[model samples]
Every structure is written in structure tokens, then in C-alpha cells.
Target: MTKAYDLARDAYAAWGVDTEAALAALSAIAISVHCWQGDDVGGFERKSGTSGGGIQATGNHPGRARTPDELRADLDFAFSQIPGRHRLNLHAFYLDSADNPDRDQIEYRHFTPWVDWARDRGLGLDFNPTFFAHAKADDNLTLSHPDPGIRDFWIEHGRRSRDIAARIGAALDSPCVNNIWVPDGYKDTPVDRMAARQRLWASLDAMLAPAHDPAHLLDAVESKLFGIGVEACTVGSHEFYMGYAARRDIALCLDMGHFHPTESVADKLSAVALSISNLLLHVSRPMRWDSDHVVLLNDDLLAMAQELVFAGLLGRTRIGLDFFDATISRTAAWVTGVRNMQKALLRALLLPQAHLKTAEEQLDFTARLLWTEEVKDLPHGAVWAEFCARHEVPAGTALISSLNAYQQKVAARG
Candidate 1:
């Protein structure tokens, strides 16, 4: 160890925190890097569809992947730059096959390329059934449409997606978290909210009725507060999915950008952990609204890691990134976001959590406040530098220089 890291290590050790254990634990927490970031959520589907979902990636950055191969190459570079082994969160619309099947006709073979790729890299793969940016979803309503035919079509698509996810998980020997998030909502206030929710309830039942090995496939439902057009009401609100997940015994996804600015997802973790068996966190930065900005080492992100580490929820919570900023280098965005998340987790692990809790329990508010603030000024930077060094990844200006070089390499993309 360097003199700096040795001193930092000794300092943390004095606080009754095991820096070595923290580093080891931080390495094990793999953040599922979203594949959509590489291509700004534009999947390689061969159909004319409007990108009219609540989600939209702003700016026309150079080198946005137009093909699955290109996206994979970008992902490969992003993963190489990020420390620790991580999983790729794949969307169904990113299918790679000559069949060019519609959503309803999608099968397992369509994702064979991705599975093979992940297998080769010793990385686990997560799945998402894309329920937006299509002709059927043009109205911002899907799976809960009034027309039975449209609902049936979406239901079949979800069923096939689960099957594909199951096969992928089985192949990789990892449970694939197939998270479902739909844009079924109303721009203006609707009179009959009950009807739409009823339809959605039935569609979800039919879609998830097919039995799959729980060891291979895990189902999760994601909820949103509001989308661009769906400002009045989102069909799958937080309360709706929280109750559903609790009743159905499935995982609930909590996106950092999907809630109001005042809300603290960090506080909800302990409460939600009481109701649900598992959780999937979509870590992102929300700029005033759900703008989906690239994540940074901000207060909210730090609090999230603190909750996970303090509450001992990291084992049951699957951490995934969900942001798409096309204004910057996509690969740089990925590397930055993932590394920030790792950094936050590392900081949490290095905290004297037990002592802080004891202080709180003993009603020693002064000690609690003092200890928390003191950690902020500690030589955590030295420990983090040691971490990046051990992982053979660059930091500070070196990282920026490497990302700039990569941007130049991919700048020729039309």
C-alpha cells in the first residue's frame, strides 16, 4: 500500500472500521449498467414507431450506437473502464436476429447474441420488457388499453419477454430480474381511473400466469410519478405497485428519478423492506424533473448507499443504473455513473455504522452529529484512490483523458 492509503487505512481502523472488509464488500456490489444508455434507449427494431413515451433522451451526441454490435462494443469499453464486474440491463426492443419479429412474436432466440456475449464475459444479464415507443403505445397507454385486442397483444409480449428472461438466466446461472414498467396514464384528468387499473390488473395476471423456475427468473414491477404527457395521473403509481408487489410476493423497482423532488427514496428502503422480499433500485439523478441526468456523487446518491449499507439491505436489493444523457460521450457517462455508485457504496462501507447506531440508541445526538460530519473530512479520497489503483482503473485527469481518447475513436459515426 502507498503511504497515503496506509495512513488512511490506519485512520479508519482507529474508528473501528475495517477498511479491507469495506473494499471487499464494495467490490461485490455489482451495479447493473443499463444498455439503453449506450444508444439513448433507441433499440434496433426494424419498424416505424414514434418515440412518444414519457422517456426521451435529449441532444444529438455523436457515436450513439445504431446497431446491436456497435452498442455491445460501446458497452464493452464502458465495462472495461468501470471497476468491479457488473451486469448489463438489457431491454427486449434490443433484439438481435434476422427474423425481425414484432413485439408479440419475440422469442428467446432473438436475444441469443446478448446471452452469448454475457456468458463469454462472465457477467449476469437483467431484462426489461419495453412497453413504450411503439404504435400501440402512441397514446401512452399499454397493457391497460380499453380495447381487449391491444391489451392481449401487450400481454403476449410480456409473457414472451419473461420466457426469454428465464432462458437467459438459466444459461448464465443467475436469476434475471425482468422488470416491467408501462406508460399507461392520462395527460388530462381522467374520469374512469378504476377501469384502466382493472384492465392492467387482469393483463398483468395473464402475462405472469405462465410458470417459470423462480431460480432463473424474478419478476419486478416499476412505477412512475409522472411522464411528460402523462402529468395528470400515472396508472401504475407507487402505491399501486407497492401493494401489488407486497401481495404478489415479487420485487418492486424504485427509480430515483420517478419520484417527486422532495421525496427521499432513502427513507423508504427500510419501510419497503418490511413489505417486500426483494427490491430493484434504478439509480439516477433527476434535475428538477425526471430529466434522467447522469448520476453523480451527490447527497441523494450517498444517502441511498448509506441506507443499503446501514440497513443491511444490499444483499436483497439489486442496484441498477437508469439514465441516458446523449449530450456527452455515452461511454463516459456509463463509466462515470457506475464508478460514482461504487464510490458511494465504498464510503458507506467505511463508516462506523455500529457506533453511529449506538450513539443514536443512547440518545447521544451530539456524538451522532459529530461522528457523521467528521467522516466527510476523513481521507476517504486516499482510500478511494487505492481502490481504483487495485482495480487497474484510472481516476481524476487520467480517467478524463482516457474517455476523451475513446470519444475520438468513435467520433466518425454517421
Candidate 2:
């Protein structure tokens, strides 16, 4: 394997690509893996009936983590199989509460265990305000709800979430990316769209008014094109959030699965980077709609990585995974999605960017096309294998056996 990597390294070197530098850079990147994937987005909050959040995890896959300990154990197993250190993304509803508390009343004490867990493992943490699947959101309106009392409830929840995120970051000494994504929209065209948006704008302003140290917390707002119930009009559309983020100078989250099926979220990276100082990408796969399937090393994923690399915006971007698949082993899903994302980044780093850029600058379009096609056939797999080996992780299909053994001995245990 070392010989193969040596040869591959020489080949990349000929293209003016430093394989060692690429590996070092890739190692420094930490993708935020969402915790919802392990438990099908089910939180410990006491909510009767099914989730009303316009989102649903469509499988009864056994072995879903029922407690905070189980979830942490599963996350530990998943992280072991994937190379590189990564952060964990959590929702406010996932609080370790014995007496299910209301969203607005949640305090940081409920999440101290998570902080301790992450601190002990040397992992960073990110957070989200759970604006869905709760009683306040039962009417499909949260921050935009006409009733001031109801709107205030959600606003307070958002505020508490940000404070908690700051605490997590302060405890770990790493800035936590606290993202806000509300499931407020209409199933059909509304008579007062403008009024609803106005209310939402005001609500956000109030929620984000309290200043937290930027060193400990970074704020972001996520938008979606549509969802299961909010088909006709989503209050937080892409245009809305983009404008708000630019005007407010906050990070904008570009969720891969939250856009139109025909639109490439990768293409929007550079465009959004122009206005927003920091960007957060919620990497996911969209099947027809916002299905939130496990990510694959497909063209879209590759394009996103290449765009980030080419634009030299990787350091400024927060890359995170946002998929949940319950049909397969949850731990396996986490490992597969995170590894595929790492693979995409590695492939992007292996590209002969200097040559390609020179060809384009010289107006040698043919040469640019030729080099692009040629690099695709290069021995990237060998380099990736070497990366995994260096990181002391299983390369290629070898991870499957480890995942299976873990499922039987740990995840599947009642």
C-alpha cells in the first residue's frame, strides 16, 4: 500500500499537486455530523403523536438509540470507523430531560452531560433550535404565528438555544455553529404572505438581538424551498434567508436537500460567499424532494467539494452532514455518509488546480477539458486508501465487517 501511495504521490507531484499538503489540509477539516440520523430525528421531548414538522423518517429500523447514553455510544462507534475528527450537531429537543420541559424553558443544565461527553472525547459540538415537532408548532406556524404569545414562545426557544450553544463552545473552546431553521410555511397560497414574512422578520430580529461572543458562537439561518406540508409557500425561502443573512451579516446555511431538485447547491456556494462572511453547508442527498437520504460520492457531492476548494473558501465554510436513513443500520449510515463526504473532499484536493486554472486563463479550453478528464482517471483510490491507513481506519469495503460486528455486539443489544 505504501508503494502504491508513493507512485500515486509522484503522479500528483507531476501535476504540481502536493499530496502531503492535501492530506494535512483534509485532516484539519471537521465535518459536523448530525445526531438526528442515529435516532430518526426523535427527540426525548414529551410530545404526543407523530412528528408534525413536515419531515418524517420513514422506517422502523430496529436498534434506534432510546437514551442519551445509547446515542453517544452509537456516535462513538460511528466516529471510530470514519477518518478525521468531526463535530456533533444536536437539536434543542435532544436534551437529557427526565421531566420533558417546554422548548422556551430549556436550560443549558439539561445538556451538560453532552458537553462532558464531547469534552472527554475531544470533540466539538454544534446546536440547533428545535422549532418543529412541538405543540407550539402544531399549527404549522412558529415565529410567524399571528398570536404574539405563541411567537414569543418560539423566539425564547431560539434565544435559549443560542445561549446553550455559546456555553457548549465556551466549554470546548471551539466556536459552535448554532443554526436556525423554522418549519413555518403554508400548504397553500396564503392571503397575507407579506404580513407573515414581516412577522417572521421581526421575530428573528428579537431572537438574534442578544449578542454572544463570536469566538464562542457563530449564528446561521437555514432556508428551505418546501417541505411535506408546506408545499405551496415556505416562509423561510432561499431568497428570504439569503437577503436576511446578507443584511444582518450572519452565516447562511445552504442545505443541499433544501433546494429545488434541479438546482445544484454547489453552484450557489461562490454566489453566497460574496455576501456572507461565513457559510454553513448542510450536506445531504435529495431524492425527488427533500428526502434526506444518506449522501453518496456522486457528481453533486464532488462538485460541492471542488467548488469549495477552487474558491479557497474551505477554511471559511462549515461543512456538515444532514441526512437520516432508518432502513439500514443507523451507525452504518453515519459512517457511510461521513466517509463519502471525506472521500469527495479528498478527490477535490487531488485535482490539478494550477494546471486547470492556467489552461483556462490561457483560453486553452481544449487543454482544460483534457486535463479535467485525465485527472478523473488518476489513482485517487490509492491515495485515499493511504489516507485511511495513515489515519488508522479501515479502507474501502473493509469497514463493513467492523460495522456488522458492532451492530451485533452493541447496537442490536436490547
Candidate 3:
């Protein structure tokens, strides 16, 4: 019998990822940039110094602060890097430096250059906004209170964002500063959370009701753990006014990395599929402690995510890499993660629709349920060994060489 991996290899190899077509698929591309190269290596398409709430490539890794010119050069580099025919879009997330010349300057001078750079790359500016108000050089800041300083900081921050929007709209261009994440939702008490929620969506309300074009929408990202409100933040969105947001056609950003043990992947994707106006795709892996490892796909999580995509639950979704590369330099991390993700995606496209259907259909509730509950705790080698033993995949030294050769062939393209 032909195995799934063989099918995946064949399907992906022949898969028509026409460059021009792929470029057209991007609503935005959340890019990962490094400080060390500055404007070298042709820069990046979405040349931001950061990507996620904590994925500050420059700070997390060792990179320098780029001057605007260098940043522009980086943009040019990225623009030229993608084949003009390929469909690569941009979503720029500028790491709003607290040390910059006030909120106004950061928005106008610091961030705008990159926004313009995005245009040069045939991209758009759909930022995730800044992550909370407070400044912390500590990983220990997770789930901490919204520092008073941070809250006030964000207020002024939002104002500056509004200024930039006016500038972009005045130019008749689309300017979106997406506010989809709240890193400060961890609290212990059965707390009154309305005020906090209001602060989160105030700008979104402005966009939906009395603001500019009703087409201008904010994407809300829902999570399952490890931030304000321990269990306070559920897997799916539980905002203060979801109905109002929905009425406005406010969309949701579904991060595959955020689903927990209890949430049914099928159920969640179906729900997200309905809200297309404001969709953001965040992909990552869940580790032993529920920590976001930002690892490769095939993590079982993406298997579930793929099931949704295959079912047409995520039609025309804009995907973003809200990932982290903690072990290596941020630049290298981008190359590794993005390359691996493409491989996983190709595998997804190659998955046997019939097999998946049969598995789901044939599954006894008790047996199929094991997939949702059982997360491997041992080293990956052992886990893979066990899985290979059960699934009957090609194993041993030759298998490693085969996979490596596959990766090398894919990587050597550029």
C-alpha cells in the first residue's frame, strides 16, 4: 500500500504554486526581520523588527536598531527577493519602541517608513499593534497585571495610530492596525472584566459604527491559555461584545497554536469560518506545559487545523506566522520555520481526503477521542518511534536521510 508520506511528496511536488498566484493570496504577511543585516541580504517584504507579542527578533536575538534608510533598503531587498510573479503580500508589525521620540514620532516617523516600504514590496500595512502598555525585559512578565504605565502608554499609542490611519486614508490607501491580542488578561479573581474589554475594543468600535468606511474591520484573536485571567482567556473569543462586533462584521484571527485540550478543533474552525471579514491566521505548536514552542507542523495540532481547512471551513483565509525562534537568531528562525511550514502545508494538500473521512467516520468515539487527549511527553525520538511503530512508516537511518534530502531539495531552490 502507498503510504501517506509518499502521497504527500508526490502531490506537493506537482502542486501548482504559481508565483503570481501566490502573491495575490496575501492580505498581509507578518514578516520576521533581523537587526544585524540592517539593509543587507535584500532585506524583507514585511521588514518589521518583530512579529508576535513576544517575538521581538531584534531583542530576543542579537540585532541592531535600523535607521529608516536601512529599513527601506531592507524593504527593497524583500520586494526584489520574491519573484514578481509570486503572490506575496505584506502585514507589517512595527515594534513600537517606548524609547522613541514620543508616540507621535514612532507612528509618523519610525513606523511609516516601513509602511511605505511595504507598498514598495506590493504589500499592505496591517499591524497587530503593540503588545500591552508596560515595558518589561523579563519573560517573567507573562500573565502580570496591566501595568498602569502600559495602559496609559497604549492610550497615547492608539492616538498615534489614528493619526497614521488618517494619513494613509488621505492617500486613499488601506491602513489597518489590527488589534487581535491581549497579553494582559491573566487575573485570579472572579473579576469584573468589562472595563478591560472596553479598553481592548474601543478603536474597533470606532471603526465599525461611526468611524470611516464600514469595510475597515478589526480582527480579534482568541487564545486558550497562559496570559491574563488564567482560564480567563478561552480558546475561542469571549469578548465583552462579540455580538456587536459580529454585527459590524468584525472578524476573528484563529491561531492554530492556541487551542487547548478541551476545545474540539472541528467545532472551533467551523465557528471561525463564519466570520470571514476579520480573519487572522496564527500558526504554531503547543508543547508539554502548554507553552507556545513555535515548532514545526505535524505536531498533531496542525493535523486538526488541516481538517478544518480541508472541510472548507477556512475559505480564502489570510495566513500569518505569529511564531517565535527562541533557540536561534531571529533571521535564521524565519527561514527555518517558514520553510518547514511550507512543507507541512504541502503535506496537508496531499493528505488523503478519503482516508481522513474514513478515519473520522470509522472512529469509535472512545478510540478517536484519544487523539484529542493524548499528548506525548517523552523525547520526540521516542514519540516518533512509537508512532512509526503504530503507523508502520519507513523507519531507521535511511528514513532520516530521505527526510533530510527532501528538506535540502526544498531549501536549495533559492
lDDT of 2 by residue, 84-105 (tens): 8999999998998676678888
Q: How many residue pairs clash in each candidate?
A: 0, 0, 20
TM-score of each: 0.99, 0.98, 0.57
Candidate 1: worst-modelled 10 consecutive residues by lDDT = 47-56
Angstrom error of the Cα, residue 108, model 2: value is: 0.8
Best by lDDT: 1
Higher-ranked by TM-score: 1 or 3: 1
Ranking by lDDT: 1, 2, 3
List candidate 3 segments past 4 Å from native: 1-101, 104-109, 131-156, 159-177, 194-210, 214-224, 228-244, 259-267, 275-277, 352-414
**At residue 276, what lDDT does model 1 achieve?**
98
Q: Candidate 1 on 1-414: residue-level lDDT in tens? A: 799999999999999999999999988888899999998888989976785588889888899898999999999999888888999999999999988788999999999999999999999999999899899998898998998889998999999999999999999999999999999999999999999888888899899999999899999999899988999989999998998899889999999999999999999999999989999999999989777999999999999999999999999999999999999999999999999999999999999999999999999999999999998888998888999889888888999999999999997898
- The candidate, 2 or 3, that scores higher on lDDT is 2
- Least well predicted 10-residue stretch by lDDT in candidate 2: 43-52
lDDT per residue for candidate 3 within 61-142, as digits (tens), equals 3332144453444334323322121122222234323343433234544455555555565554554434333343132122
